[model samples]
Target: MIVMSVVGVTALAVGGGALLMTDNNASAAKETPAQQAAARAGMTVKCPDVATSLSNVPQQARPAVNNELAKMDSQVADAYQRLAEPGAKADQESVRTRVLDPLTSERRQTLDRIATEIEKVQPRPSGLDSLAACTVKQDQAAAADAQAAAPNTPAAGNTAPAAGAQGTGGQGTGAQGTGGQQQSGPQRADFVDIRKVKPNVKNPRVQGKGSKGTFSSRCGRNENKHFNSDNVIVAPGVSNGAHHMHDYVGNKKTDAFASNQVLESAGTTCTNGDRSTHYWPVLRLQDGTKEFDAGAPGGGTEGNVGRILRPTSVQLSFKGNPVSKVVEMPKFLRIITGDAKAFTNGTANANASWSCTGFENRQLKDKYPLCPKGSNVVRTFKFQSCWDGKNIDSANHRTHVAFARADGSCQQGFKAIPQLVQRITYKLAPGARNFAVDSFPEQLHKPVTDHGDFINVMSQKLMKQAVSCINSGRKCG
Candidate 1:
């Protein structure tokens, strides 16, 4: 019996030891698979969700990194070329639109959201589980306790008293509640298309009268007075039919000295629709008038444009002031193309005619010598001294300009067109009025100014002159 008991006890003890060994092996088995995989695959045991935690980095720093990456791929050459171009305004707009503005707005919104999320983690002591989970029981109990409390009962440290509590107005729960009311929105703009306006068939009346023959007030005058031959009434400040007034009424003679002849023939009417009339301070408007006053008394026939007295009864008004006596004189003659070297020395044929717009000319006389002498038309005064901005001779500046003449020939030199007559002078005699004229100013239309090569030549000359003057201790100016 004793021998049997010892053997049984030894067997029980051996079985218990084996069970303890199995428990230790089971714990090792739990960690072995992960450790083996990490070692075999050369992988790490870091958190799989690491991106989510690191994404919590301040949003502001993210854009800076993105901008840096964009710059690495940017076209540096194209940017420099654009910057080097003339009138290259700084492009700060790109920085604001592409980077700063969007980054600032998004960062503000993200910061607000982060603050709200932080508030979600209950206001607990530091080191407490920031990610702690909460069940419904705690919330429910707190709600129930709050409801069961007396109505209007002031909570601790509250300014306003509770509705049914003992506290008066002094301690009442400060309920001047500015509740979560959204801010009032701004008023939106109303948009409409202005192109919907109907075209008015009847012309607008002239309301303003400017100077002599110039109707400054366009609001009240007749529509016919303002309308051109094409029935198009030009708006104020536009270069239209009225602007050609002087061109239309230029000197009535081709020969400057001939009383019967015009500075050039009134070849054609651009618009044959209607003949415009002007209110003059001279003799009556007659079919056949002769022997008119020359107006100029002395000064060597410089201003003596031939005139004819009218047989019909006449009235006169000068500069808008009514004059008692009337003497009809032919309009001022415009010298359209004459010599840049010599103006009056220009050749004349029976059909000779010239064309230049925005040119001015004064007849050569002993007092005001024709261009290049003491005349306003001359610019080459002291050869080198004519470079002064103050000494600009605007008349002769158009001298070298080339323009098509009424005879279809090219003419050179300075020429003037009577402002009223220019409208009709350039057209073929048979059809002046209907002709469509280019409205380009003389400067834009003619190649008068030597721009490219001339600039370099003049610059080099000036530089040499400047150095010479400096070395000689003399003033270049």
Candidate 2:
């Protein structure tokens, strides 16, 4: 799959579908073996994303609302575990009775509480009750495999080429199947050779008033081993909110419970004295070696296993806007660039870009690139650059920031701010393809679910310096 920069315009590609079923005896006779296999694969829970509907949460109600939202995520995760258990898929009626029904009840109660909390401060939000129900769908990995096996058909996930296509630099098989680990995915269909992909990356057009400079932050490759499964920006005060381990860099004090005041007073890993927090899901090799979090809630217990692989290089750079001078990012401005639930939520918000060190021009959004010998796997995130001038965040954590248009201009009423580009590279063993990133169990370690998080805690002086450097067309660190 070719992934363009977040600021550039790309056509929306929808893949995957609900479970396929034949209605009559005539249709059943024509069903292929791949179709039968897909029909027998395990099911997953799909729920409406309540957070996305919240556009005007009052300030006093945010904490309560946020906690409720986090609770809904936990509810889904728990339901998924039940769905994956032995005998859980014995039959459709059994699954509905044992898992789906209970989950719907829990979600309904939680949604009610969230509505009550909001009503205490403002008018109650309508339609939340409608989001309470969840449904079972065919496992996406199985669906992709079935699609890949069909003649003249592309996989029903991301835009990677058909399976076993020639000229892909490395072995066509996936790396995650090693050590007999019971991972749900990183299936063979999820990888493609980097050499086969066309160069599809394009930058926004830089106009006459564009800020042409760049500012880089010298943060080490997580040498201190700051890893956790907490998300302070999205689920503050809630432990294990992320449900997958994260590799953190920049701010030394970051977790679900860290307040803005705590962050302001905390130390930093950035050599430039920037205290901003940056983090993303940790990548792991499926070599069967157990890490410290093994058996823990966010690690083995949550289906994220294997030895964590440290990145060889992590580059955090802030670049100028393409169409106008840049303004300083507000302190505590939080941005989440990619969708961590892309496997189930679809790819409308998925922004993960995977490539190889030498093949940087060819980016893959849905498939993990198979790098040839001597090449390292690379993950890059280009964050949104247009900020709503008044708020540091929004109810959904995304509305406060927007990506610039294809021409690199901010929408009316939005201001152009420095765009953050996070690039991390990992050196894997030659021909090794058994690596996967940590993710929610239902996400199945898919590359499309890879995401990054950022919170700007830069000092006022540093923020001003970055703005000045960008507007002046100078490269500064």
Candidate 3:
């Protein structure tokens, strides 16, 4: 009858999985009726005040902290959502293995990072105290989830478990009757939603290293003097003024108000003749010198303006809506990647898009970190490609395009298209070489504002070709 028991064998860890099912089941056999009742009815806890404590963090480190927090909250929230799945309640072990375990590890690292930054600036541990409390509450809930996932079994005695034991894999309790409810409403996300949350494990419908539809342009580059916002189109031809400055690549005639007609006719940066105008914020040196712009997108120049060049390759592929192929994307849709508003408006990083010497093995943070000598500094981008099947643009220019779930599936109601991930690299070997992306002066050369903007100007002919390549499962470059 005993359902829950306080693990007595190990030190209660915050994020790491606490105890094994063997330990719990071994003890559960002896639990009295009272213990079972308490176990069925999980403990009560209070929510942590994350914002008020974040105020104490250094202004410079706030974005990184905020970004990390969003990720953590998202981690837990995804688990809760899955907990509502059909089998989630029965197999707590499977749920813990796939979801909770990873969630705890990520939370641990995030808390440690927040703590480190807190110590760097302020003496009072306000942020740490609050975040720590939040983790503790989450940990308690996760433990209950694990316990609930464990099957009620008789004591197996004091027999020791083998090394690297993966646990009983039995049917136990889950987040259903244990983990507390978040909020009331159909729109409520079990976790925080600064942006949409992708699934934990993405099972690609079409999987491979080469299945892609690509368009290349050798058009020259253009580096504006400052961070330029192409908000003019969204703002109705405001002329050279938007959110921040941007460096346009591909199509020649690119301004906030430039239409598809203008873009199609403009000369392209692509030597191969693709006239697509691709652009992102410019990267400038911290010193604000002309030399740093050496490798930048040369507005009137061709081939590796200063330092920028047509990315070695521009890859496009379509991802199914978490399960099936995507339909055609409406023309003239405005898809914005990364956070431009964050750099200027003092809001949380929208995309928190980052870069590193090696995109696979990440190390940099909110800003672009200076890579060591003899390294290929890579600029990475993850665009919002999934469509809501309706609006081309939202009030924030983001809500319209849904993000892929943890498993790389488009959120419900969103049709998945090619989640275009443009990873560009620069050959800047170690030393005092000149290379940096233009960022807010306070941003300190970090790659936070490194967002991308693309207008779908593909004529019906070209669009049809792209659709064929994707739907037919061919790699067209």
RMSD (CA, Å), each prediction: 42.2, 7.0, 20.6
TM-score-sorted candidate list, best first: 2, 3, 1
- The ten-residue window of minimal lDDT in model 2 covers 6-15
The residue-by-residue lDDT of candidate 1 on 191-288, one tens digit each, is: 11112222322312322221112111011112122212110111111222111111111112111122212212332111221112221111111111
Give all TM-scores, in the order shown. Answer: 0.13, 0.86, 0.47
Across 402-441, the per-residue lDDT of candidate 2 in tens digits comes to 9999889989999999999999999987656678899887
After superposition, candidate 2 runs with Cα above 4 Å error:
1-42, 143-182
Residue pairs in steric clash, candidate 2?
175-433, 175-434, 176-434
Give candidate 1 misplaced runs (Cα > 4 Å).
1-292, 298-344, 348-395, 404-477
Question: Which one is best on TM-score?
Answer: 2
After best superposition, candidate 2 residue 412: deviation in angstroms?
Answer: 0.5
For candidate 3, which ten residues in a row score worst on lDDT?
182-191
Candidate 3 regions with alpha-carbon error over 4 angstroms = 1-230, 233-236, 242-244, 271-274, 286-288, 291-322, 343-349, 356-359, 363-365, 370-373, 431-435, 440-445
Better of 2 and 3 by lDDT: 2
Worst 10 residues of 1 by lDDT: 181-190
